[model samples]
Target: MRSIGLILLLCTSLDSYKILIYNSKYGHSHSNFLGSIADALVDAGHDVTSLIPVMNPKLKDGTENSKIIRIEPDQQVLDSYAKEKENYNYFELNSFNPLIAIFMGPKFPKKFEYVCRKVLDEPGLIDRLKAEHFDVYISENFDVCGTALAHAIAPKTMIGSYSSALTGQHFSEFGVPEAISYRPAAYMTSLDVHSMVDRAWNFYASLHHKYCFWFLRLSINRLMKERFGEEYPSVAEQSANVAYVLTNSEPLIEFAAPTMARVINVPGIGAKTPKPLDEYWSEVMTRRDQTILLSFGSVVKSIQLHPAVKAAIVKTISRFPSITFIWKYEEPDDEFAKEAAAKLPNLVLTKWMPQLDILAHPRLYVFITHGGMGSTQETALRGVPGIFVPIFGDQMKNAGMMEYNGFGKVFDKNNLGDADKLTATIKEVLENKKYRENAQRISKMLAKKPFSSKEQLVKYVEFAAEFGASAALRPQSVDMSFVTYHNLDVILASAACIFIFVYLICKMCSRTAVKLVALISGKTKNE
Candidate 1:
């Protein structure tokens, strides 16, 4: 018995690990993904220390078992960047206007660099990181600074977490085949079954994405060199050292794209299990025969919506007196919204609500959302059909996917002021049996996965830490140059060979014809 106890203790000690997580994004959904990973790591008997930006939504306080460190940036710099980000138009990318890219592209990189520098400049942060001696570093992939920080900390292993759906260019960076012919960009509305024009557009979009990132990498590298000294490696080099990437995507829902073995899909990692609604909310939901959840996600506030659009939504929903509408309005004190809510007996206005809990409720008939990836996946998990109003970024693409899958419809945000169109779209979604059927079909397919997302995430993280890096998992293409990786050199060489062979064949034929002509002339002269 003494021997067995000693062996068990040894095994436990061997299994324990220390992990550091960096999540600098201030968005709620982004933070949720990082927080979920931290929680899962802690549950697996690992010590997790999370470093987050002070502007982010407060995560749960650290217990004796785990730690959370918040890094506060210079107040003035943080405020300036926050205001700029708030005003930036993420929707311009979807306008299909080349001029928009020209105007926004240069500005985006500068802003991103500024934010990264500010986060790293936090006092005592570097000293704290140097002392941790974490076995592994996990960070969200949106910011290159996280990758830089990981390199600076010099962890045994590094993992990148992508909170959004997969992008073709992102896959290409790791030498994963993008299959752009069929796989649409996350911001595109193209389908797998595409026409020649669609394929052309996809190819162009893929190139643009690759080029933009290449330019951004150059900019980040210059910034890092200036800040960290010329001896330090570039951001791209740091990114290449990443051993694994975890994506928030499901194969069943997203368009198929080739992924490296190291790229793991753990869709909906941060989604909460359904919980019982509070008494008042439970009573409210019970009173209604049918309920619709209307939320534009965390970034887009309901109170800030155009007055004309708000009036249109109210008018459209009011047409259905029997149905209850639960709007996740951010500002409950807004007099305009309050007055409007008072006039409608069926409308409920709340500043905060348990989104997942409400979505899973039996009364929920449909979800009217802004098509953020988090909300999109959650709705899919609950098998609830949606009416997507995409405002920016990948939201339009997600909305298109929802429509293509027959689970919902995409209502143009430009038509928000049109009550009739909004009413027709809502009516169509509610009355269509195909929409509900497809949603349930997708839900069942996702449910059939062998392992839960949490299980897959925890397993891969542990594997990466134990193994350090998988040489076999790192593809040979990672070592290849851009020309070789894309096979451009091979294509050009093949074209040259074919050209030379064709030229030689034509020359031989010409020489043979000339000899025959000479023989005929000689015979004629002899006669």
Candidate 2:
């Protein structure tokens, strides 16, 4: 493990550019990703400054190859996160159900503005960012205004990082059409969990996301143009033109679309390393026994599980006493705790386990995940088959892709059955050699490349800084007619149809009048 870390450290020496990585939000997963990339860059011998907001942060120069800029998260702003207080409640089936997940698309602009204003006002944060002339700005695509803010301050380029499915919704904002059916890699092909009806709904939901992202981009660009001068390019143009985007996912976990060679595959960047306290490893693999890790992911906590669903899982897994169940319960409770004891002797309940650590454990055999990108990568890297319970967003797409690749199964919350099915699925993954074989094959492919995806991304950042945005990417369709740009083709086609119909009607009317006159004159002459 130390040697692997050393190798990673040595790889960092390959980079020579100064890069500023920004992830001001509080989520551990998001921050961990930023920290990973920054560490890699600094290890490579580049001047790297990281902007982070933690309650109490530790900033030690690990390799003496980079610097850390620590800013206290604005308590005032942190206090205003009233939305964070709301957790998923499975009892309120309305809240935890898949239907509600579709409705909870990307946040609106007002919400984004609220977050942006707080970030800007975080006492000297903006000043600190502007002071450091960054060559490239890297951030999660979901964080609304920070990237735009970075773009405004210096002649820097923006690189987008996201954990899961890079849906049509995201690319469409940059004028790329939604090709929902086009899964770019073998992993995305496995994620076909939707029924015919679910597929249609997923398509519409993805299309809806495109509009949501477009609206947000439009609003951000408009505000930025007034404040910074030039209208910003679309996210797609920005993505395509940027030096590189390092998706924290593998081609084996989700499908990425093939675009102009800028999007790079850098899997496992967000993977969690194994932790020591995972009791399931202790319980199931005491002497090399096989184990299965069950977790719903960070956003969808297991404690939020519907009581019925919990009961079903307990009843089913109770039969498979040989396998270990590491349920990621965010909080502890008497009922859930006792239920674990009653279910199976091999069941080891955990409030939290180092997910990546648990997956990487040698005895681990299967994973039941919410199909998060981070978890997806960990599962792929660990070479484990999965039972996917897709709750929302790209999770649905990811679950579908994994199933498509013969590595997993999708059990929708609405139709998830009894313990027999659950036990059967686990047995199938454990007994069937194909699952392990496929997972290992994909993991090998993910690791075959010489440079980690982040290193390649750093190269792109330097490329963008050296060359202007124009050099990195050209504007696609700049003729900005509001009506024409949106769908003038439809309007033009409609206008042509109207003209033809009018001419045909006029010609028929003239012929009818001539016939009527001729008939009247002939009758009068005969009389």
Work out the TM-score per prediction.
0.91, 0.76
What tens digits encode model 1's per-residue C-alpha lDDT throughout 367-436? 9999988998988988999999888767877888788788799888888789999999999999989999
Best-fitting candidate, scored by TM-score: 1
| Candidate models: Cα lDDT each | 0.77, 0.61
Each model's backbone clash number: 0, 21
- When summed lDDT is taken over every stretch of 10 residues in candidate 2, the lowest stretch is 55-64
Regions more than 4 Å wrong, model 1: 1-10, 55-65, 85-95, 119-131, 207-216, 229-231
Best by lDDT: 1
Over 1-527, each residue of candidate 2 has an lDDT whose tens digit, in order, gives 99999988777654456577766544545666667777777655667777654432333322233465555544544444444446445323432234443454434454455555555556776666777777777766665465566555453666666644455444533333345554432122232435565455555555555555565666666666665577655443344444455566566555545553455556666454566645745555564377777887655667666677778888877777666666767665667767676756767777776667667777888888877666677777777788887765566656776776667677665644466677777778778888788888877777676777667755666666566455434325333344665688888899999999999999999999999999999999999
Model 2: per-residue Cα lDDT at residue 193: 34
Off by over 4 Å in 2: 1-15, 53-87, 90-112, 122-128, 181-199, 211-243, 272-284, 331-335, 415-417, 470-472, 475-527
